[model samples]
Target: MPSHRAAGLVAGLLWLASLWLPAISLAARHADMDLQAFEQNGWWLLTAGWVGIFSGQPAWLANLLVIGLVPTLLMGKQPPWWVSLACAALSLLSLALPGTTIHFDGGPYRVVAFDIGYWLWLLAAQIPALLMLTELNVRRRAK
Candidate 1:
């Protein structure tokens, strides 16, 4: 079994890689009533997404799961099982991002689809917690 630290490091690397890949496809109606679509990657979301909150996009808040996991994963030792479970639960918040409406440049865009980056990010977010849960189960069975 992999150690928590190893799992964390792997997850961290995945999260980093995800930042550069396409995350979401957004569609909005132009002034002429034509629909336009564009893609945004994870880094864009991490940096500029804050402005989205005021524009009725709450999915950005799910980024906090990754933010919160960073310090815990960096710790010297494994956190309690409950901490892992909490992280897992928090990671689920990202699922709500799909179909969400984001107002940008006076136009409302819908999150039409999630791309590779978003899926990778979700996988990365769950890795450490899943590893921790597996470890806990193993230990319990051993005892």
Candidate 2:
């Protein structure tokens, strides 16, 4: 449980840290939109998701983080689960997105911003559900 708690905190911290990098650059009116924009920002999402999963931030915090991340997509939103899945997908998609790109180059941007932002958002959001699952697993073991 202590480990779980630490993971949640790390995830939440990642999200908090993520706001300032590529996503923010994309959001600003006069962003550089250079390769560097995507580089660290791309990594930020992955880090946040991993940290969130490990830290066990509260579900409400995840929901809020998702909201903060959605604007980076500049696309229509979906259910939280969709966002969460997208993040996991992005972690894999980095091979495709690669380094040195703007945050709005259609596929690259959506895959990056939406995946990282929405996904991390979704991850934090689902912590409660995971807790329930963990609890059930524990109960089954006891039985």
Candidate 3:
């Protein structure tokens, strides 16, 4: 069996992998819309902040890149509580973002539904925080 730290590290790595997959897809509802709209439209966690179509780079403010991707690169090092909390909070907030809304050129707006990527991103981003809480709980009981 793996130690708690090892398990956490594995979980963190898996979480990071999810960030690289497509985070969203844009689709056009009518023929008047651009056909490219259906293409996978999103950046992985690494470039999620700079790439993609959003107002003022909203992803930078709430992205797994900062929390999930970065920390996972550190290997098995346990992240501080603040880091976990921030990651969890930001990931959750991203879910609330209007990612489905797609703007058109001199046409009506098209809203695309979130694909599996969005849901996976949300779940993966929260792993660190959940692991942190579990660790804290275990430590408390051991005391």
Candidate 4:
């Protein structure tokens, strides 16, 4: 297999593994809130996050977009480099999640920290783009 395809496989595996890891820690703004700090795993977010969109939290869309990377990398002989780059850009939208308030269980919560899963997910989204860029650079140099 080509290096880029190998890299894409690795990325896809990383993303799948990250699904079982904790992605974020959320804290209630009020001291008296029934729930305190809550850790949400990637699987939970990926499976149930569509509700966030209805609740006006579009950042979850970024998480959803990362799925695009899997097929783009695995389905074809080679996808355009720009497609991978676009996936990378969309994956970064999760960065906007930190300061945004989310309504959960009738309470407002803020994301206080990103965990390993989040970083891994971001990395997975980026790997294809990075590899494609390097491949393009190598091709240019061969000219």
The best candidate by TM-score is 4
- Return the TM-score for candidate 3, rounded to 2 decimals: 0.61
Candidate 2 Cα outliers beyond 4 Å, as residue runs: 1-4, 21-115
Compute each candidate's TM-score over C-alphas: 0.81, 0.34, 0.61, 0.82
Which of the two candidates, 1 or 2, achieves a greater lDDT against the reference? 1
Candidate 4 residue pairs in backbone clash: none
* CA RMSD, predictions in order: 2.8, 12.5, 4.5, 2.6
3 or 4, greater by lDDT:
4
C-alpha lDDT values of all predictions: 0.74, 0.41, 0.55, 0.75
Q: Give the per-residue lDDT digits (tens) of candidate 2, residues 1-143.
A: 55345445645565555454343122222345544322335345544434333333222333444444334222332224445554444333333332223334343332234435444443544443354456569889999
Task: State how far residue 62 of model 3 sits from its true place (Å).
Answer: 4.8
Write one digit per residue (lDDT tens) for candidate 4, span 14-72.
Answer: 88877999998988847664668888998987877677777665555555445665665
Q: Model 3, range 22-78, lDDT digits (tens) per residue?
A: 655554546755465553433443453444335543444545344444445356566
Best by lDDT: 4
| lDDT for 32 (candidate 3) | 52
Per-candidate clashes come to 0, 12, 0, 0
Clashing pairs in 1: none
Total backbone clashes of candidate 1, pairs 3 or more residues apart or in separate chains: 0
